[model samples]
Target: MCTTKRGKIVGYCANELPCCDFTAKNTGSCGTVRVGSSSSPSAVFQSPDYPDFSSGDLNCNFQFDISNVSNKGYDGIQLNFEDAYMEGPGFARHSPCETDMIFIRGFKYWQPPAWCGNLTGYVAVIDKTKNTAFLKVVNILALMSGFRYKWRISVSLIKRSATSKNSETEMENMENELYPSPNINYADIQPQPEVRQSESRSNHRSRFHTKRHAPIFSDNSEDEEMDPIAEPFIVNGEDTNITDVPWQASIRTFYPDSFLKMASKTINNTDKFNQEKEGCSMEGRHFCGASIISNKHVLCAAHCFHGMTKLYGFKRLDHVKVFLGETDLCEDDLVKYGRKSQNYSIDKIIFHYGYDDIILMHDVVILKLKEKIKFNDYIKPIALSKRNKVYYGQQAKSSGWGLTNLTAKGASLPTILQSTGKMFVENKTYCDAFLEKGWAASKSLMASYPKYYNAYESVFCTSSKNDSISKLVGSGDSGGSIIVFDKTHDPPLPVQIGIVSYGLDGLESKREHDNVFVDFFQSVSFYRDWIDLAMSV
Candidate 1:
C-alpha cells in the first residue's frame, strides 16, 4: 500500500527510483512513498478523498479494504512487532526486521522465534470466504528521538473483510491463522507477456487479461533480495522446489514497428551524429528524453551524458546534442536508412532542486535547442501525462540506444527508439500483512522512514511487471520517458507517464508477473498549479 524505496511503491523493485539522491533522501511523490531507514520520517501522506483517522478509538477493530491485486507483491498481508523476539538460525541476519514466520508441515525449519525475519510463508485465501488473510503485531515500540509507536500491522489484499471490525485481538488471531503450505505448488505459475507478443496487436491489446500468479516461497536467503523485477519459476514443490535465485530480468521485444508506426510525428533533426565512440550511437538503440513541458526546454537524465554531474554539471548545451528522426545513429548505418540526424544541445543544466548528487532521483536534466522546433512532420512534442493517467495495458515505450544487460551496460546518444507496452494503475492494496513480516509499528527505509500514516490509508500504483519476458528501461535510457498510447482517446491518444527514472535488476529491469509504475500523475497532479506558476514566471 506504500511506495517502497524500490515498487515505485517499493517499489521493485529497486524501487522507489528517484530523480536524484537528494530527492530520494527527502519527501518523494505521494503515489511514490520513499521511506528512509535512518528512523526518520520523510514520506508524507495526504488524501482528501479519505477521512482523517484522528478521533478513532485506539482499541477499535480496524478492518482494511485491499483490492485489485492478484500476487504476493501486489496483494497480501504483513505485521510488525516492535522490540519483538527472534529465535532461530539466521534471525540475526534478518534482525532489525520485525517479522512473523511459519513453517508448513514437513518443512524442516530450525527456527522458532515465532517472530519475524527472513521468514517465508505461502499466502492463502480460506475458501475465498474472506478472500483475505490475517496478521498480528504483539510488540510495543519504544519512543526514540521522540518517536513512540504502537504495534503496526498491514495486509495487501484486493479486499478486506468489510463485515469485521478492526481490533488488536482480531488482527492477531488472523496473523496466526495464516499457515505455510508445506508442499507449495508451482505448477500454475503464470507465464510472461501472459499473452503472446503475436496476439497483442494494437487492436487486440487488452485482450491480454490482468495476470495473476502465486509469488515464489523459498527458504534460500536470496529469495528476499529486493529487486524491482522478478522471474517466473518452474519448480517441483513435491521435490524440494527451489526457484530461489535473485530476480533476473530478461525483457525481449517483439513487433516494435507497430509502436514506432503509431508515433506519427517525431522530433527529427538536420545534422547527423558522428559518434566519437562505437556503442553510444543513437541508431535505433538510443533512447529519447524530453523536457518539453514547454517549447525551448527538453528534459533528460544526468547519466545520459558521458560525464558525471561533478564533472559535467557546468557543461553548456552546445556540447550536448539530441537526435530525433534517425533510428540508426551510427554513421555507417546511415548508408542503409538514407537519412540524416537532428541534433540539439544542452542549453542549461539544473538538476532537480532536491536531487541526490550521487544516486538516483537526480537523473533529470534540461536541454535547450538552438532554435524553436518547428512541430512538423517528424519533429513535435509528446503531450506529457504530467497530470492525467492513460490506463492499463496501453503501450508504454522507451526509446534509446543503450545496453540491455548487466555486464555490457553502456550509454548512448540518439540511439534507436525502442518501445514496450505500459502497465497501468493497479488497485490500492493493504500492506498490513507486510507488518507481520516485520516487528515494529514504526516505518522504515535506509533508517529514516516518513511517518504519515496514523490510521489505514492505501498507496496507489501503476503496474508494469512483465513476468514472461523482462521488458524494462535499460542504461543510457535512464531519464527516458514511459509513454502509453491510449486507444480509447480521440484518434488514439498518446499520453506521457513521467520519465523512466530507474529499474530494479540493475541494467536488466526486474519485471515480474506484472509491473507497477510510480504514477507520475499522482505526484505532479496536485502540483499543476505550482507548475503553471513556474511556467508563467
Candidate 2:
C-alpha cells in the first residue's frame, strides 16, 4: 500500500507499515535519496521508478554525501551522469528553464548549466570544501518524446592520491569562481546607524522636526485599472481568518527584556518615556511581521534586524527565527487545531544597498532560512506586484500583531494576528502632504530624521479604508505586508506591494495618545530587481 503522511508520498510500503524494499528509511524520505559512504566510496543512483521514470509526472531529488571521510587530506567527490535524459519545457533558451530540468545545488551556482537538455555523458567534480551536493529532476507534463524519459548517475569519493595534480587545480579554480568562502565575521557586522542622529541624541524624541504643508494630487489617472477579480473584500474587527493572508510571517528576535509585556506587569508610561529619553532602551524579546516570497526566503524591513541598536543592543542572526502557519501566539496546542507552525533560523540576511537608518529609505531586507520551508495552505508566498508602473486607489491589506489601542499601556498588544484594509494614496506628493503636516511630532523632530524629509523617494503611503475608526500600522507591525489582490492568476492571488516601516505619532508618543498619521511602507515595485537578485543568491 502507498504510504502518505502530511500530504506527501512517504513510500511504497505494503499495509502502510513502512516496509523496507520500496520504502525509504528515515532521513530518506521527502523526494530525497542519499548515496555513497566511507565503506563503499562509490555507488550508482537511478531515476525514480528507475528505467521507467516516464511512467508518471516525475519530481525527485538525490543527494551525495562525503561527510564520512575521516582522512585529513581527502580530495573530494565526482559525479557523472550516464545516458541523462531530461525533457526541458521548450527549445528556446529561457523557455526551457521553466520545464523539466535537473537542478543542482550546494555548488557554486543555483543550477548547473550542463543539465539543460536530454544530452548524456556530463560530469561534475565537487571539491572537499563542501560535504554535500544535491540534484533535483522535475518532469511535470505528460510524455513528450526525445525529452528526458530516464537517467542514471554515478557518485564516487576522490582521495588526494586518486586524481592528477592538473584535475585538482581545475576543480579548485571552479570553486573559487562559483562558491567563494562562506566565512562571515559576526563581530564585524554592525548596523549602519542613523546618519544625522548622534549617540547622545534623545531616543524618546525624533531629532528632525518639520512644519510645512503642500497641496498634493492623486495620480490615479495614470494608474491601470486593476483586474475585476482583484476587487476589495470586507472583514470586521481585528482577528483575521487564517486563509485570508497565508503569506504573513512572524519575524521574531530575542532581547534581554521582553518587548511584549503584560498590562499589569508593564512599567508606567512616565517611567518608559523617561527611559527612552536617555537612549533607545528596549525590553527583552520583540517581534515584527514579514511576508514570505519563496520556500526559502521572506521579505522584511531592515530595521527588524538593526533598529535602535544602542537601545535594543547590537543584533545577531542567532537570536532570530521566522514563524509560519500560526495566527495566535497564545495558542499552546496548535496541532490539536490542525495548525502546525514551523520555526526556521536565519541563514543569511541581504539588505538593500541603499538602506538608510536616518531617512529609512530602501528599508527592505530579504531573510534566507537555514532550511527550505514546506509550503501548505496555512503558509505560502505572496506574489510580487507585476505591474511595471505605479497605481493608486487600490485597496490593500496589512496584517500583524501590533497594538490595538494607541492609548493603552502594556496591555495594548494583541495575541492574535490582526488585519485591516487601506487605500493607496495617489502618488508620493499626496503621501508627503500627510507625512509632513499631520504627524503629532514637531517639525524639529521630522528635520532631525532626514528620511522623513524625502517621503516620496522610496516609500508608499496608505490610510484606513473604514472612515469611522481610523486604522493605522504601529510598532510591532514593522516588516509586515501591504497586499493587493491579483486577478492575473486563476483564482486571483494576493500580491505584496509594500513592507510596513514606521508610523507617525499623534502629538505625543506617550500613553493615552493616538498616532494620527498615514502609514508608510517600502515600495516593493521599486525594488523588484533587487528582490530577484536576493532570492537567487
Candidate 3:
C-alpha cells in the first residue's frame, strides 16, 4: 500500500502505481534548496520523481537562493530549461494553463514570462540585484486515473569580465548624464499671486478658453496614425508646484455633516468617531485628479465619479468638490502657501455616453463648476491638443498628488504634488505589444479584465528607457493631464494631450524594469469633439 499525504499518495511506493520505480522508497518532494558561490556555481532541479509519473496530485516548490553570488563577482543568474512538458490547453479553455501550471517569482528587476506546457530550451535571465528565485509546480487533479506532468531546469550564476563590467558602468553613467535630474524647489520660486484680476482677464474668462465651436476633425480622422517613440512615466516621482502645472485640479469627495452626525450617533466609540471624522475630511477625501479646460469646466476620468457613485450612492455628486492652484493638501501647508488653493463646488458631471468601466473605454468626464474661476498667475487653463496632431516620440509631463510609492504600507498619498520628468509618448502598436507581453504573466489580470485589448485604440501609452523615479504613477493620479509641447505655435505651447487613466497595479509595478514601465492615458485628441459638445452645455 502507498502512504498518503495531503489527499495524495507520497509518490509510487513499491510499484503500487504504474510508471513508478519499484526500488524507490520516496521519490517526490524537493522542498527548498539553497545555492550560492559558497557551495556550487550551478544546480539542476527537476519535478518530483523525475522520469516516472508520480502518483496522485502534485504540488512541488523549489526555491533557488543566490544572495551571496553578487558579492563573489557574479553579475546575474541564468535559468536554462532542458525539458518542460505539462498539461497543455483544453482544461480551462480560457487560460493557457488551468489544470496544471508553473509559477516563477522573486526576481526584482526582470519579469519572467509564464511557464507551462512544453517550454523546452527556454532561457530566463535575472539581474544580480535579485537574491532569490522561486518555481512552483501545481497539478490540480493529478490522479492515478489522470494525466501527470514533469519539468527540469538548470540555474547557473553569470560572472562578468572586468572589461564588460567597466563598459556597463560607462553606459549607465552616459544614460544618467543624458537625462539630468530636476532638483529645483518649486515652492521657493512660485510667482506672487496678483491682488486683483486685470482688466483684460475680466473681459475674457480665460486666455486659453475657446468659444463653443463645431468639431474640428471629422469622425473618419478618429483612427490615429502613430509613429513609435521610446520614453516612459510615475510611482517614484518628484515634488512640483501649482505654478508649474497651473491647470492641475484635485477632485475630492468628502462626507457631509449630516452623514457624520448620523454615524456619530450610530457608533458610540470615541476612537471610531475621530477616525471617521479625519478620514471623511477634505484632506483624506482626495480621490482623483483633473485639468482645467475653461473657467467653468475641467476634464477628468469618468471612473473616478463612477467609483464614488458605487460607494456613496447616486447622491455622491453632492459631496464632491474641485480644488485648483493647490500643491499641498495639509491645512498647515495651505496656510504657509498664502492660501493659494481655491475650492469650488461642482454643478454637474457629464460622463461620456460610450464610457465602459470593464475595458475603460472613453473613460472621461467633464465637470462643470457652479461658478466661474478667477484666473491668476498661479491658476490658468491649458490649451487642448489639436485633433489632427499626434505628439508621438515627444517628451511629456504629468503631475498629481498621487501615492509616491505603490509598495509602501497603507495609503501613501504625498502631501505635495508629484510630477514626472523625462517621459515620452508611445504609439498604439507598441503599447498593445507591451500590454500583451506584460499581462500574459499575470493570470489574475487575464481572468478579471479579459477585454483589456480593447483599450489599445483610444489610449496613449508612456514609458522611459532609463530606470528613473519618473517612470510610474499611482492610485490617485487618474484624470490628471499628460501634457506635451506643441512646437507648431510660436513659443511651443503646452498642450493637454492625454488624461491619466489606468496602468499596472502595485504587484505588477514591482516586477516592471526600466523600459517596461508603461502607463496608459486617454487620448485627448481622440475625444476632442465630445469634449467640445460637453463644454458647450
Please give the CA lDDT of all the candidate structures: 0.28, 0.50, 0.54
TM-score of 2: 0.48
Better of 1 and 3 by TM-score: 3
lDDT of 1 by residue, 418-494 (tens): 44443343332312222212212333332232112211121122334544344444433444454444343333434
Expressed as tens digits, the lDDT of each residue in 75-188 for candidate 2 is 444555555555444432123333444544543233223243443433444433211222222111122223225677666654534222333244233323422222223243
Sliding window of 10 residues with minimal summed lDDT for model 2: 206-215
TM-score top scorer: 3
Cα-based TM-score, every candidate: 0.38, 0.48, 0.49
- Per candidate, the number of residue pairs that clash is 125, 24, 11
Ranking of all candidate structures by their lDDT, best first: 3, 2, 1
Better of 2 and 3 by TM-score: 3
Candidate 1 to native Cα RMSD, angstroms: 23.1
The residue-level lDDT of candidate 1 at 60 comes to 18
